[model samples]
Target: MEPLPSLEVIKLDEAPLAFTLATLFEPSSVLSQKLVPQLHEKLKSSPSPPTSYGELIGLAIDQVRTWNVDLQAKFISGHPRIGETKNLSMLSAKEQGANSDRPTVQPTPPKVLARLAHLNAYYERCYPKLVYIVFVNGRSRAEIVRVLEDHLGLAHSLSIDEPALETADPVDVGSQKWLDELERAVRDVGLIAKSRLIALNVA
Candidate 1:
């Protein structure tokens, strides 16, 4: 459980993930704040401009996969039920009163799977892409990966290896300062998007 990298001041590439990270960490930016209105307006008008806000949000979600290595490792390491060290004793106790030979018991893997599914559904409803950054604490990457895998299913090609998790660090003060600036930007952009959306509806 090493200190995770400081996400605050990392130089973001010119990708959608960068924007998404900016928006998530800095939701109160003037730009983000203004985006709502702008989006409203555009939606109202017949000829709306093609906006990249949605794509940016989606990109932010994509970057979350990078940290998945740590997340998955933690999840898997912690949850013995999914891996080798499963707690069959607990299961047996729960099924003690039932038909011992034909007991109806649910394994930890399925429960973990269900939890992951719930997380995915929650994120999808909140935004377009899957949002797992907010949950990055000092937990093991395996744990996080397992949940994501269960929810997203095998179809998702995201990987969370041990090496990736080992390389994580906490967000530094400098990074935090930069993130604050980014947050402001996101707010500003969001505001604009909102405004456009409103305007469009009115039109």
Candidate 2:
């Protein structure tokens, strides 16, 4: 459907599905490389096609869950740390707005920014298997920092607590939102293993 508005997604329709799947994943990312084919096959064979971009993302989430734990950890590793700007994928920089260190959409207090940095480091140490994933939405800098703090407490839970979207030449809203939500979902789900590890006192 019209090239899916520049989110780098191909329409789920049959005609171009194969062509699109070929490039959906970054070649360097094993998780994406592994999943793209499976996703294409799953959608191609389904009795009913995905109704929306979000549904396609939901399928992706389900697919990620079925992967081996080692691969799941590898998936989360692909994400950049919060506020990280340099070396971002084009989509990432656009979505995060100047990266975490220097946001222009809304400025955050230096203290809060510092706290976020601390959590990024601390969280990685606690649960090296997963990266922190907050949807950002359109929250003010303060709000974004608040969620980062909240996630700190839930480190053991890997739970997603609300407050979570996307444009053509710009990204279509649906595809971008799907990208945001699905990645967060993957990270959240990936944390399940770490929580288990912690519970068993193995982490």
Candidate 3:
């Protein structure tokens, strides 16, 4: 196992919803068995059921869109001067000569900051579960372990890199290696766990 690149926590505002939704909705070889079941449960508790797949997807899409909108609103309110400062020092010699020799002091707009704060609050409230996916790009096992311990708050029961496992092809050697490493890590923490390659693939 190698230490992977630091996983970036994409802010809700920064995410491109259309791209994310496209990827999420595309059919993959690794589908979560619980996805449909969980969706069904949620729908049963809801006031109304979606009439079609399009409607269902639309509902999900709308939720994300609404969140972004709310975040943008809050950001705008909190930061009002986001785009008004000019710096003479950083400009080209010709431009600098036209202005004073002082650095620009453009502050974040109050409205934008407010919107960002709102989005942060919404994400924290909605998704308490912080999902982390690690990708190995040729680093040492010790470094990876250290990073996992320091930043991710890994626990005995917490699944590591679950999405990777879910998306891995069963016949691929790399996937098998990934499974082996994950299982080893789990067992090292004294948990009795089974790999999907064994349980799902075999079954």
RMSD of each predicted structure: 18.8, 14.8, 22.8
Candidates, ranked, TM-score: 2, 1, 3
Model 1 CA lDDT for position 71: 36
List the candidate 2 regions with Cα displacement exceeding 4 Å: 1-28, 98-113, 154-203
Q: Compare the candidates by TM-score and give the number of the best one.
A: 2
Q: Kindly report which residue pairs in candidate 2 clash with one another.
A: 83-100, 167-170, 167-171, 167-172, 168-171
lDDT of each: 0.32, 0.48, 0.29
What is the per-residue lDDT of model 1 for residues 102-175, given as tens digits with 9 covering 90 to 100?
32333334444444444444433332221333222222334654545454333332332322332333333235
- For candidate 2, the per-residue lDDT at 117 reads 62
Q: CA lDDT of 125 in candidate 1? A: 37
Q: Please give the lDDT score at residue 78 for candidate 2.
A: 62
Off by over 4 Å in 3: 1-24, 29-31, 60-203
Tens-digit lDDT track of model 3 for 80-143: 1112123211211111121223223333334433433333233222222212223222222333
Greater-lDDT candidate between 2 and 3? 2
